[model samples]
Target: MSFPSFLSHRLSLVQEQQLELAVLAEHVKRGSGHMRRLALECLAQRQAELAADLAQVAQLAAPRAALRKEVAA
Candidate 1:
């Protein structure tokens, strides 16, 4: 996909993850022992996924950014 489209897709994924985390946070607050544990686990997993997504974006962006700098120079 083109960079714009690729960024859009990633943005959506980030937004969805954010929403999921919000819901999970509520569950953690109100849930009992087992339920809270499950919510916390899901939250941790989601956070890791988000971190990976961000890292991938940065990795992809670095090359394009360097190309832009070369063009400008």
Candidate 2:
């Protein structure tokens, strides 16, 4: 199956954000003072973005999934 270019781009962005969140989590664990605080804030923002992207991906894929089910029936 092929995805629209925009969907592919969004998926890649989501993957990148997930990786960044992992790194930020590590920074939060080992960092201290202002740096740790900054990392925590960034983590929160990235988490929100990831949630939004996941929702968009789900919305885009829903129709394709339904079509597949209809074809199978």
Candidate 3:
């Protein structure tokens, strides 16, 4: 084969490889975006649960404050 034909064949092979790489990159980006969204949702749910627990703790402590004040007087 001539040098020109050899280079042309190699160029076509490189192009095909580049196309495959682009497709793989896109797939990874989409998967990462989906995972990020799921993580954020899980974080929000955990925050809500913590807030509820804090509120319950505060409610339980309220009655104790009055009793302590009465004892101090």
Reference-based TM-score, model 3: 0.54
In the range 1-73, model 2's lDDT, one tens digit per residue, is 4587878888889999999999999999999999999999999998998999899999998998899999999
- lDDT tens per residue, model 1, 1-73: 9896997799889889889989999999999999999999999999899889988888888898999999999
**Global lDDT scores for all candidate models:** 0.90, 0.93, 0.59
Best by lDDT: 2
Clashes per model (N, Cα, C within 3 A): 0, 0, 0
lDDT against true structure, model 2: 0.93
Question: Model 1 compared with the native: what TM-score?
Answer: 0.85
RMSD of each: 1.3, 2.2, 28.2
Clashing pairs in 3: none
Residue 59 lDDT (model 2): 100
Q: Worst 10-residue stretch by lDDT in candidate 1?
A: 53-62
* Model 3: CA > 4 A from native: 1-32
TM-score of each: 0.85, 0.86, 0.54
Ranking by TM-score: 2, 1, 3
